[model samples]
Target: MTYTIRQAVAADLPLLADIERAAGALFADANIGEVDVDDVAELRLIESVARAGGVFVAVKDDAPVGFILAAPLDIHIHIYELSVHPAHGRQGLGRRLVDAVCDDASARGFKAVTLSTFRDVPWNAPFYASCGFRILDPAEWTPAFYLAHYHEADMGLPLERRCFMRKELK
Candidate 1:
């Protein structure tokens, strides 16, 4: 099926929230218990998608199947979130969304893009590695990156073991 990727509008908030909830539940089921399904972060995500960022939704035959959210962070673009509906997994939609975000970062003159995901999850770290993101070594990581990881840790997330990945856009 052909999916069209387009910028998200305010009207897309409801569906986006639904997608986030479904994706979060899938993660929880995969043993990622650190995530709180009822957390307000999902609401904040919708707000982020509506401002200072770009959200690309993959719509197939008029139905939203997946979406990716990208926002500038210092000199790089951070892929805040990307999720494909559970039913749509392994269908290339995720990669397509990432590719679109990278293209946008390149066009905006960003030097790189960064994201973090569970290190041992098949649907996380390994998937990103295949897309050219290399796991950053803690010793070589920037102070900002370290702080970000620490913040995640404070949020009850197991970020100490999560892999921070970065891909140069240039």
Candidate 2:
């Protein structure tokens, strides 16, 4: 049950992508239309985050079971991706990853953490709600956050099913 949270390294990019694939499978039965397991995180992006210390991995038994990637977008820390292998689900790895990102954001003087997820997915929006993220009103959205809705829609993810959420850092 013990896991270590540490900055991701060069060797973890592929493993993180693998974990992303396994975690994305959980959406298969959510009836969210489709599950694109092949759309895992790209190695270059992962490597960039890893090099910049914006990525963290939950390691158990010397293997990465989960990872979270964050980036500074405008005035906030945007959680670009968070994925935990299905086998590690419900073990709090995801929350821990979010906390890790939040800590880094605080260190960087960011005011909030932001992310987007499917509102109807049991483990997506609801889980984030439990973590103190509330749905962001359009008026509250930064230009990038506002445009992300259309970007997602253009990518085939219905706008109505997805939403941006924010958690203020205090």
Candidate 3:
């Protein structure tokens, strides 16, 4: 199916939260404890990120089916969240969203794109690795990376099972 990728507007913000919830549900079957109960990005946060030109939606039939939220952190753009409704999964929407952020960051002269994800989840760190991201060792953590990990830990995520990854943009 055809899909359009574009920066999100205010009207698209609420749908992004819904998409996040739906996409996150898949984790229920992954043997990861309670990930499905994790909170999604709130509309306010999504809106704030969008205002920064860091929210992008994948649209089909004029409605958002997936989205990626990002923000400037240090010299890189950090992907705060990425979600695609399961009905549209395994069709490259996630990669498209990642590419959208990477391309925009490249054009704007950002050095890289960064994110934190579950280290052992097949669709988490491994998928990002396939997208050219490398798992960043703690020694490589920037201030922004440290801050990201702090927030993730505060959210009750298992730090030992989590890792930060980065994809440098040319």
Candidate 4:
């Protein structure tokens, strides 16, 4: 199926919220625990990206099926969020979204792109690793990165750690 990816507009907020909720629900069902979904601060962060970053949504027949959000982080790019509706899973939408973000980062001359994901969850860290991200040591991470992007949701599993991952844009 053909899908279009384009910059999201302000009018897309409600649909984007729905996508967030759906994606959160998927995580919960997978035993990832509840994300701090009602946090207004987090919502505002996403809003900021929607307003400024390379915020792109995947649409099928003009309805949003997924979205990828990225923003500048010093000399690097940080992928704040990327989600595809459960209905569209295994259809390559997620990969396309990440590719779009990476393409933008490279075009903008960013040296690297970074993200964090659950260490043990099959759908979380491993998925990113398959796409060429490697685990980063916390001690080597910058204070600003730890402050801006790290969250408890990245560590929902008791025995599982949250790991930072980075990919060089070269």
Predicted model with the maximum lDDT? 3
CA lDDT scores, all candidates in order? 0.79, 0.87, 0.88, 0.75
Structure candidate 4, residue pairs in collision: none
What TM-score does model 3 achieve against the real structure? 0.95
Count of backbone clashes for each model? 0, 0, 0, 0
Evaluated at residue 85, the lDDT of candidate 1 is 82
Estimate the Cα RMSD of every predicted model relative to the unseen true structure: 1.9, 1.1, 1.2, 2.8
Question: lDDT by residue for model 1 over 64-130, one digit each (tens)?
Answer: 8888887876578888788888777778988989998999889888888898788988878899999
lDDT of 3 by residue, 122-157 (tens): 889999999999999999999878887898788778
Question: How far off is residue 125 in model 3, in Å?
Answer: 0.7
Q: Model 4, range 36-77, lDDT digits (tens) per residue?
A: 554322556667987666688888988898998888776678
Superposed by TM-score, candidate 4 places the C-alpha of residue 113 at a distance from the truth, in angstroms, of 0.8
Cα misplacement distance, residue 26 of candidate 4 (Å): 1.5
- lDDT winner between candidates 2 and 4: 2
Model 2 local distance difference test score: 0.87
